[model samples]
Target: MKKLINDPKNVVNEAVAGFEVAHADIVRVSHDPVFIVRADAPLHGKVGIVSGGGSGHEPMHGGFVGFGMLDAAVPGPVFTSPTPDPILAATQAVDGGAGVLHIVKNYTGDVLNFETAADLAAADGIQVRTVIINDDVAVKDSLYTAGRRGVAGTILVEKIAGAAAERGDDLDAVTAVAEKVNSHVRTMGVALTPCVVPHAGEPSFTLADDEIEIGIGIHGEPGRERIKLEPADAIVDRLLGPILEDLPFASGDEVLLLVNGMGGTPQIELYIVFRRAAEVLQECGITVTRSLVGNYTTSLEMAGASISVLKLDDELTALWDAPVQTAALRWGR
Candidate 1:
């Protein structure tokens, strides 16, 4: 595996340090390890927003930390959950007088850890609310399992709900918007190649030259199925079919589409995916209201892409269009 880093053990802290130097105006490191809070944090009675997951999905929970997104992000080990201590610290650091909202993905460890942190914060008299994002349509939701893992769609929830909080919406209103976003979004992903975790020092899973795994999770969990490699259009059909059939987004439904790249995919390939995704949406009579493409979230050196669709209403569209300045995404001049 080829990567530019000194040691696997220090990867998270080293990356966070570099991130702080690169985005000094927007983020600051906590006294605790692997936790990054907004430089302008402690929004002083504004509902604090905290989200995190394993490392390697850069520009996610961390890159979203800024003026109108997440207020703090707790980092886990590569593709692992942040333990209870850092998560609790993140909750405490961002909690203004209003409350703190934890945006947790639906992974088992992540869900359990964030849930524990929320409980601990409540014990400290900090109002803590959480919106668990399980937007991945790939996983079968059942009584036994943890449901679908939260994927790229969580970014949309964070953006829209953080906008609500930035406008001085109450904690309940912020949490409500987050829940609303969670309801509107669904995602499915596919992988062309496996990614090598730094510590693992090898690919998490293997894919042959002419094979692709459909319905992949970001962390290299087993996908729904593996199929022979096909052209971009055919690949998109496979990706979008379940999303459309299950969600049944009908004609004239306006939507937001995010074509996200796993770390190793190129922009050219992403655009190829986007081109077909747009065509498929148009053919289905769905209106593509807004679109974002590129590596908003990534697994470490993984060659894959996930398509996330959020059916949008006026409120969601307005919140999505609001100004956002962060290291990974910036808009609204």
Candidate 2:
């Protein structure tokens, strides 16, 4: 309930306004039907990439709008999917004649809305493709999704796919690269505390002081189980076990390991988790070639973290190393 805002109903609008002003150099915002696009959009001949979901996960679809990432991002209300109108607007705004790709997380509302927008864009003569990200190894189905709920691994899809598009890959090629990333990546999260939506004025879920939820979804959905608080290494093992087993990532496999904060977890704690995760991977003979540890995708101000492992090949490794300039993630630029 304690948040800095003028009104609960206006949280998204106001936040979007602030974000526009703060990151103006890299992005431009459209108000009528809210959407964020790279400052220099419609990169003719390069495939346009767009992804979106609820607004709470900052620096996600929106912060990722820039060169070598997303061309456009449509954000809905907190933990809510955006309507078709804004999605279509974003699609049109980024279409540069080559095509547009929709990188949607596997949420029911997001999937349907993006599908509708894609059909509408197609009718307008814009070639459109869609890739559903289902990288969560936590659950096969959640209240918000029919299949495995997409989690932190979504950023991997957007980044890798955007790199392919930036390199002038065609629509099909970009979509293929996106699908490949989704398939190779696996993620699992643990929540120590729940987040409160601005409008709701109450935490989405409850957790005892010494309790934790393992395999949690980004939107505060029920996870695999709730258990007493354990050491950071033990929790990391629980999460990474399912991920490594699900992908069957074996010895000699190279990976890009991401230790992502849910929202409120500190950077120091994240590195603590990463240390143990790295040690475990080394023990298994898996090579941690690339690593990312931070709050890239979040759920408002929840105190938690998720671990993502992306099995990498030579092509994926190169694409991941490509230059990217975005509000949240900027390197090799």
Candidate 3:
């Protein structure tokens, strides 16, 4: 309930305004539909990449709108899907005559809304393709999705897909690369605390000081099970075990690792978890070629972390190394 905001209803809009002010050089914000597009959008002849979801996960769909990444990012209210209107506007705003690709998580609302928007845009002469991210190995079916939920692995999809689009790949090509990433990626998370949505005025879920929820969802949804807290090494093992087994990575496999903090976990703890992750992968003969450790995707103020592993091939490796410049991720300018 103790949120730094003038009004709960205005949180998303005000946050978008703040983002525009803080990163005006890189992005431009629009209203009515409420989307943010790359400052130099409609890149002629290049496929436009667009993604959006609930608003609480900052530096996600929006923070990622920029050069070498997304051209447009639409945001909804906290834990809510953006309506079709904004998504359509976003598609139109960034359509440079080539086409547009929608990267959607496997949430029910997200799928429905994005699909409707895509259908609408296609009718309006904008060629649109979609690649859904369902990399969360945490669940096969949940309250929100029929299959696995899309988690931190989404960041990987965005990065690799964005690179493909930035390199002027056609819509089909970009979508293929994105689909490849989604298929090869897997993620799992644990939570020590929960988040309070501005409207709810209370923590969505709660945990004891000595307990933790494994396979925690980004929106504070319950995980698979709860257990007493363990050491970082054991926690990392439990998380990585399922991911590695699910992909069934082979010896000498190269992979990209992401150790993401859920908003409240500090850098020190994230690095601690990363250390164990790296060690565990090494023991399994997996090479951590590219590793990103930070709060790239997050719950509002939850204290926990998620581990994402992407089994990489030559094509994915090259795309992963490709240049990217965004608010949360930047390299090779």
Candidate 4:
């Protein structure tokens, strides 16, 4: 119930307005049915990348719309999947004679809506393709998803694939890179507190002072289980153990590590978890060539953290290092 806003229903509108103004040099916001497109959209001959989901996970589909990242992002209500209209608008806005790629999460509503958008765009003579992200190693089924839910690993996929598109890779090439990241990455999260959707005016879930939800999804989906709170090192181990085991990462394997805060977790604590994650990977002889530590994705004001590990190869690493200028991520520019 405690949040800064004039009206609960207007959170997404207000937030996007502020965001557009703040990052206007890099992005442009279109209203009357909302969508975000890069400041220099419709880059002739470049394949466009579009992605979206519920609104609370900030700096995600929207913040990533510039430079070597997404060209457009459609946002829905808080924790609600967007309908197809804005998505189709985004598709049309970014199409520049080349194709468009839709980077979608595995949530049911999101999957359906994006699929509809792709179909609508195709009917309008625009080539459209999609790559779904289902990297959460937490649960096979959850509240909003049929299979595993997409989580922090999505940022890695967007970065790598967006770079491919920016490098003039065809739609097939861009989609292949995205799928590659999704297949090689694994993520798990633990939540200390659930977030409140502005309209609902209540926490999405509940937990006691000494309890934590392990392997949680970004939208407060049920995780593997809940347990008594543990120390930072223990939590990090629990998050990374399954990831390393699920992927056939042997010694000397190079990987990219993302220690992401789920909105309310502090930077110091995330770094503490990252420190433990780095040590564990070192023990396993996995070399972390790149690491990002911060709130790249978040659940409203939830207090939690997630870990994403991507087994990398030469191509992915190089693309990841490409110049990317955006609201949240910028490097080598």
TM-score of each: 0.97, 0.99, 0.99, 0.99
**lDDT (C-alpha, whole model) for all candidates:** 0.89, 0.95, 0.93, 0.93
Residues 1-333 of candidate 2: C-alpha lDDT, one tens digit per residue? 788889899999998999999999999999989999999998888899999999999878798999999999999999999999999999999999999999999999999999999999999999999999999999887889898998899999999999999999999999999999999999999999999999899998899999999999999999999999999999999999999999799999999999999999999999999999999999999999999999899999999999999999999999999999999888998
| Decoy 3 TM-score against native | 0.99
**Lowest summed lDDT window (length 10), candidate 3:** 138-147
Per-prediction CA RMSD (Å):
1.6, 0.7, 0.8, 0.7
Kindly report which residue stretches of model 3 are placed more than 4 angstroms away from their true locations once superposed.
none
Clash pairs of candidate 1? none
Candidate 1 residues 1-333, lDDT tens each? 788989999899888889989889889987455689989889897999999989999878899998888999998999889998899998888988999999998878888999898899999999988898988888775222377788899999999998999989999999999999998898999999999888889897899999999988888888789999989889889889888877778999999999999988999999999999999999999999899999988988889999999999999999999998888888883
- Summarize candidate 4's per-residue lDDT along 1-333 as a digit string, tens digits: 778898998999999999999999999999868999999999999999999999999988799999999999999999899999999999999999899999999999999999999999999999999999999998898898898898889999999999999999998899899999999999999999999998888787899999999998898988988999999999898988888888777899999999999999999999999999999999999999999999988998899999999999999999999999999999888
lDDT of 3 by residue, 189-292 (tens): 99998899999898987898999999999998777889999999999999999999998887799999999999999999999999999999999999999999
Q: What global local distance difference test value does model 2 have?
A: 0.95
Candidate 3 residue pairs in backbone clash: none
